[model samples]
Target: MNQEALTFRAATAADIDAIVALAESAYRGDSGRRGWTTESDLLGGRRTGPDEIEDFLCKPRSMVLLGELGDPPALVACAHIAAHDEVGYLGLFTVDPTLQGAGIGKRVLEEAERIVRDDWRLSTIEMTVINVREELIQYYLRRGFRRTGKFLPFPYGDARFGLPKRDDLSFEVLEKTL
Candidate 1:
């Protein structure tokens, strides 16, 4: 993949469906299996929906950043960043399943950190990963995020998050100072 061809921008309401689709393709169902980020083996149901994306887009100090590529521009990656006091919260990150391991995710993350440090003027950024996702956590660790050892219970009963494949699901907080 041509890393230089990728561009970043704040997603609008019009892009909600595309973002949802991208996330689902990258994290759930058979398509997600193409990438190392797939949570299909651990969970089921939709990864995200329009309501969730719209909520993020409407929130103050929050934005859904998108990464696009190609001539007509395709929505290949996305993440949700929101200001929480002096820190920035990052979530809903995903890249096209077929395009994973091509350095797109790293670029998107770097851009998110830049937005937190320069645009939001926040010194720190944090994210949560499924506690069992050691590989994913290591990926973040290599990118400067540290394990905060703060665990948050996964919303098991809530289908909005996902339908857990097992009962031992939880999230671990990770942080980085920009």
Candidate 2:
């Protein structure tokens, strides 16, 4: 694949399935094992599905961006942006596990931020990450996000979210000004 030719654009309603598949491949079980971002040890069960992703696609002032490459442009990654007070909420940021470290994620995020700031006219982008994910947190930190120490309990009953392997699982808020 000509990696340099990869591009980005807003994902449509029809893209929900591809988006879910990409998220799971990047974070779920044995398939995710092919990449460095696997959360299999920390959780189990489905990572995400059409219903959830479709909801994001249906909202106004909201959109899911899909990174593309190749002829048909496989949905290699996705991110959700929603309107918040004076900022934008960025979540569900995902990239194909096997494709990480190739700078595709960085481009997708930068494009998403551009959509949030320039199109939506927001000043900041906020997201939450598993608090114990030191490596993941560091990745965001390197991208200019700061820890706010704010947190919320992991939804234990939601198999869709992931099954916890340990106690003390929660998410911490992180933000970066655009």
Task: Please name the candidate that would achieve the greatest lDDT relative to the true structure.
Answer: 1
- Per-candidate alpha-carbon RMSD to the true structure: 0.7, 1.1
Residue 89's lDDT within candidate 1 is 95
Cα shift from native, residue 140, model 1 (Å): 0.2
Tens digits of per-residue lDDT, candidate 1, 1-178, equal: 5778999999998999999999999999999999999999999998999999999999999999999998889999999999999999999999998999999999999998999999889999999999999999999999999999899999989999999999999999999999
Instruction: Report the C-alpha lDDT of model 2 over 116-177, residue by residue, as the tens digit.
Output: 88998998889989888899899999998999889989999887788888888999999999
**Alpha-carbon error at 37 in model 1, in Å?**
0.2
Which portions of model 2 miss their true places by more than 4 Å? none
Cα lDDT of candidate 1 equals 0.94
The alpha-carbon root-mean-square deviation between model 1 and the true structure, to one decimal in Å, is 0.7
The alpha-carbon deviation from the true structure for residue 172 of candidate 2, after best TM-score superposition, in angstroms, is 0.6
The weakest ten consecutive residues by lDDT in model 1 span: 1-10
Top candidate, metric TM-score: 1
